[model samples]
Target: MRWMSTVPASDCGRAGTKSSEARLQVDAWVAKRGGERAMAVRARARLVELVAYARTRSPYYRHLYRGLPSKVTELAALPVTDKSQLMAAFDDWVTDPAITLERARAFAEDPALIGRPFGGHYSLSTTSGTTGKRGIFLHDARQWAVTSAMATRMLTGWLTVRDTARIAACGGRTALVVPDDAHVGGAVMAARLRGRSRVAALSVHRPLEELVEALNDLRPAVLAPSASLGVLLAGQAEAGRLRIAPALVCLGAEGLPMAEHARIGRALAGAKVRATYNANECPFLSYSCPAGWLHVNADWAIVEPVDERYRPVPPGEASHTVLLTNLANRIQPILRYDLGDAVTVRPDPCPCGTPGPALRVQGRAADRLTIPGADGTPVTMATRPVAIVLDTVPGLDLFQIVQTGPATLRLRLAPAPGIDPDDLWDTVRARLSGLLVRRHLGHVRLERASERPQISTGGKIRPFIPATTSAKP
Candidate 1:
């Protein structure tokens, strides 16, 4: 299919802006000769450009690339960077000397600066801090433009011009149901977009009744929520409580099981149910295909599936972890960055005819824990809030909360270096107990686990695990 081929060359180039240039490059990526050969050419070209830029501008990359050949060709030759390593050197990781880790942290911490551009030039967002370290990601005007353009193209893959017009004509309100925290990527994007159009940034942390009321009142045409909460909201829609008929329902941040997807689709009564695979590191990684596969935007971003030893995994097999390199963002060079998401690449091309690799992800499905409510029935608690509490506690690096019984929870924590485990445990227990008490789970017993938390088969450390028939203590 022809993609953006009719667009004039003048339209592609936006007054010589870097972002416009990047967008134009991405536009060309779609028009490139289809298949692996074209992808390799595009990927290599972008990689060389990014590496040269990073080595010259960023101190961290300079040091990391020291002793390496001036012109690097092999991706496997580059060193891998994880959250802990990059964050430890955050001050030197960015290309802009004006952008410091301290300043970025300060900006991210302020609720008032949620959608505001950092230093009037760059947009900022933070990771959920689920993996012990919260990542602060920044995008310059150019990078932001490219990312936005990529997103628009991905949406057009599913949505037609007519569909876009209808949403715009129908008051076009998009409800973003996520944590209210300003530091998150979704919140930051929502806040910036709010300046351009109508967007309701609803918090999942709020009471369900309040969310239902707010959504019903807003009657949004587009409903975007994390996967788990989408399931709950689907129930609300199924019960006729959430009266809004959104033209599109998008789920992100978490996994969407086939059963849950079908349930949501049925509940929405013909609304398009789509899933987007995204992270704060690279917002426009992939979008769901009509065939239900995720086609990676390899031209703008590269994701390498690696085994436990960091060797490249064969297609059709799950990777121990994925390495992501964001070609769109040059301000922060995320070259060969380790993103701990288990993914399986399709060995064959998608039936939907999209170019590039298709992926199946098994990542970040934090299970909900239930406790008896005042009505003597089980009250299901969203795992995100519970996980956030422990994640926010300084010195606690890794943790897992296992519900051993109806009123018992086992907490396993891995404290950061130099942190007192006992002290950290005390803080975690106090904060978690307070949250539980507020949610009518005060009677739940919280115990410390003697063993480290076990990683899931998919190679992820799930923060919350509900007891099941096959659960082990």
Candidate 2:
């Protein structure tokens, strides 16, 4: 939810749509070239410009690159930047000198400032820290407008003429199931689509019954939700409880299993499901294709799927982690930035025939937990609500909740630097226990584990380990 871009209520100005159209046309032209080398050439040129601008503006980059050559034309020439490294130099990482970490932190945390721009020009957003490294991102109006336009392009690609007619008949209403508090994305989408369509915002944290009822009432023509929420709603529809028939169901924030996506698609009366690959740092990364690959927008951004030692991994092989470079956003230059996610770049061009690069996501997450209620019925919990409860716990970014038993659960945490482990545990226990009590899940035992969060087969930390699975991750 906080991962989505928020444009101003003024629709990012009238020029926004025109600029978007222009970007779309440029992207189309690049794709038509249908050559990876061509896309790489453009990305390399942009990388040179971005590197020059970042070195001149950002003190952090200037210091890091002080030993570098006068001209950096190759992507591999620059050093890799990680979250910890960049965040440590927070005050100087951004190109803008006026945007301080303290004020940006305060702005992103305030619910009242969710949709509002910072300094009346930049929009503030925070990442959920799925990889155990939370991040705060700032985008200028032009950057956000690019995000908004890219999003529009993605949706337009997904929707068919029949889908468009259906949406129009349904009053052009769109429903967004996003994080309740840190939902800057939902508000921005609503404001951006104003007059053209009505976007109803719903929380992913709401109880299953409540969420279903809300959807039924809204009866939205277009629906976008986290993967877990969509699956739960699919279950309700399978039981003949939920009856709304949407024209499309776009998945974001989390991953959806193929079986679940198929089931949900059938249950939702064949609404097409499109999963997007984006982040707070790079909002217009890639969009999923029916062929199951995410086509990277190489003209505007660069992704290097690399090995453990920062070496480029061969095609068809999964990389230890991927690096992202956002060329469209010069205010906060993200150049060869370490994005901690496992991915595999395809050896062959996509069958969908889109130009540039395509890849498979190795660590797309799905956080869903179901427990039996006091009345013998099951209670379902998704990522957003659980993230709201646990992500706020100070000194805790790397933690895992494993359902050890029908009612017993294990909580493993890795405290941040300088944080008292015992103190962090005590605070997290209290917060989680309170949530359980409120949700009538107090009977579920919360066990404190001596072990830290386990590394998954994909080499990332799994946030929630379901009871149905006996193995870790």
Best by TM-score: 2
On a 0 to 1 TM-score scale, where does candidate 1 land against the true structure?
0.86
Error of model 2, residue 177, in angstroms: 0.2
What digit string (tens of lDDT, one per residue) describes model 1 on residues 1-473? 11232234344324138655555646645544455556566677667777988899999999999989999888888999988788888889988898888788778767777778797678888764435356778877645665666676677777877768767865998898865555677777777767556887887667666788998888888899877778778877877887777778888877766767778878876677888887778887888876778888776678999998889999999988899888767778888888988899999888988776798887556356666666676666767666555545666668888888878899988887899988988998998888777666778899999887777765566667787522210
* Best-performing candidate as measured by lDDT: 1
Sliding window of 10 residues with minimal summed lDDT for model 1: 1-10
Runs with alpha carbons beyond 4 Å of true place in candidate 2: 1-38, 183-197, 394-397, 414-440, 448-459, 470-473
Candidate 2 TM-score, C-alpha based? 0.87
Candidate 2 local accuracy as lDDT?
A: 0.73
TM-scores, all models, native as reference? 0.86, 0.87
